[model samples]
Target chain A: MPNNRVVNKTKTVTDVMEEQTTVAPEATPAEEVIVDTAPAEMRYDTVDIDLTQSSETMLYSEVIDMGTSPDNYVGKIIKVHGQYMFFHDEMSENSYPTVVVLDATKCCATGLVFELEGDAGYPQEDQEFTVTGALDYPSSEDCPFPILKNAVITTE
Target chain B: MDKLAEYLQYPFVRYALIVGVLIALCSSLLGVPLVLKRFSFIGDGLSHVAFGAMCIATVLKLSNNMLLIMPVTIIGAVLILRTGTNTKIKGDAIIAMISVAALAFGYLIMNFSNTPNLAGDVCTTLFGSTSILTLSRADVWLCIIMSVLVLVIFVLFYHRIFAVTFDENFARATGMDTEKYNLLIAIITAVIIVLAMNLVGSLLISALIIFPAISAMRLFHNYFKVTVFSAIFAVICAFSGIIISILAGTPVGSTIVGVNVLAFAVCWSIGKLRGTAA
Candidate 1:
């Protein structure tokens, strides 16, 4: 029975080899094609800011701290699912979009401002959305909040 | 109504409602026995212990503060119950001592320690300022599981609890283990108080436990009726309080307690009117 099984395996391998030989030549050239250059800005689809399971309040706090600190979270991808908020700066007359993350108790909130890549219309205030972007600490006087640059927003 | 609907869309808000309701139910379940047994202040005492444990957990940067808080509170509960009978110091005095000490120590730790947002932390811990709205899904699950356990235990031992509460000497004389039941009550109360601290803060936990029981007592004569009414009243107050706090941007814990106070007032007035009519 073992010998018959081995023989059957060999026959299958041979059949596969024969089929591959016919297809290899056609597939080889296509497979050999290489990219000429890498893109300038690295695009990240999403970095899950999970708040549903595990220790979310602690994790959110850590994310807020990391985003605010002088450390280079710049260009690092982040995906946060949280409540959307907007701060209208009366002084600069500029509107800043922020995503607020609440702790387990909901008493404290950490607000993260994000800059959308294009002119995607801002979501309604206090709506929960999943936002993905590269972290940026803009030194501009008008807006000094930790921001997600080139962000994509989607309803949760 | 539109704004309420909008807020409900947020997962955190929904989570708060679930946890708040569960915590309210558990607290009210234990509240009846605690009030009847004259252990009303025990919830407040145990909550302070939990608060101290929370402060320590924070200082040590524990991932889940409940780990430290639960065991400490259970231990505190056991000690309080055990010492209630024989201690030279009265039970209320002992509870007050422990409660104040824990609060003071917790504050001291928060103040001297390198804990960030000390004022905010203290405020939230003591008054439950919007903490209910910040519940994670994990917290909701924990609250659900614990609340279920509490309810099951209460149901399973309902008669024993009633017997012990009304006439402990008679219960002990009738071959029932009064001490064991008392211990169980203390442990359950501690657990409920600890869970309730997140909803109403340490200072207001007694109100969470006491108000429902007392309000139900004002209207109901039978123990079962009172217990049922307390649970219903607690749930309604908790639900309404959470919604009001979310809409009005008030402190979640205090608002719930405020609702409880209002319920108590209404019950008191009803009882008075009924008494006069009778």
Candidate 2:
């Protein structure tokens, strides 16, 4: 053996890649999301609030004597807690935007201004809807608030 | 001859026969155009409106003055027809509104009123049973004369009526006032309704208007042929229904309506089969 040549074998990554490849996993069925945070005791009150407020207006708590009294609002624009400002309307404590009193009007009762909503149109609360209607005066004792008449919606 | 002798024995029975034939003729004749025009629902609506008027009359304790119901019913029929022609509210809507409202008003009057037998009386008028069998001589004569008047008018205005029924627009284009013709039809229909209320009762009389026309339509294609055929068919059904009711002791209105429905179904089936065969 006059010239014993040294044999050299080089292994390349591409040569072994075709035999072993990664497979993506199949998609799983989507699950429904649930969000229920309101307590059981105040459910009826929330419902009342939702019933009173118009579907167009948002609910806001009126601070009387620093949270001693929470007044419901509808159709009137008001500021809430320095962060959010919306139309304050009466809604039940349980239901969102539930209109407690669909109609109401402002009157001085026992040295405090009370808004009595009239019962012309049923307005739900916590829903965003723009109402272009006129203010109505008290025509009945049951509801003592101004009403929106010939109201057109800009958005819901 | 024996049956005729029997039917003629009671003056009231004679009256029923005379009144029934007249009503069947009048209704069948006018009903031809109405059915052709596809305004058949008018009969039902007008009848219900007439029923409402009858209820009102009942509440007021108008016994002999029950004839007051006719004018009110006619007025209501005219109103329904006019409103039905409006572009804003369709004919079907007007028919539905008038019928439901009239029935509702009748119910309200019956329920709220402190009158005895008012509800029963209204129910009788509505279903059309109690009125027909007990028709007096005067009612029978009135029905006959009214029917004759209606028939004469239809004969006189045959061409215009046909034109209006076929194509109202073309009728108007040909210098025939379609609105007048339509109003005439409504008025005639109202009068017919009041008359038929005495024969078939208000609730079941519409079948008399609709069935004979439908049966005739199946047998004949031409307008004149259909009208004649419808009258004949109506007479047969009326007589047969009465005879069956007498024999079976069933309600007259139900018997009549049942016979008409059966006849219509048979005719319709035959027509359908013939069409398929052709």
Backbone clashes under 3 angstroms, per model: 4, 51
Provide candidate 1's TM-score on chain A: 0.61
lDDT string for model 1 (B1-278, tens) is 87567557656678888999999999998999999999999998999988898898888888998999999999999988888777898789889888899988987887766754687788788887666655666887998999999999999999999999999999999999999999999999988888888788888989889999999999988899999999999999999998877666566787899999998999999988888211
The local distance difference test score of each candidate is 0.75, 0.58
Docking class for candidate 1:
incorrect
True contacts kept of 2: 0.00
> Which residue ranges in model 2 land beyond 4 Å of their true spot?
A1-156, B1-7, B112-114, B276-278
Q: Which 10 successive residues of model 2 chain B have the least lDDT summed?
A: B3-12
**Per-prediction TM-score, chain A only?**
0.61, 0.23
Fnat (0 to 1) per candidate:
0.04, 0.00
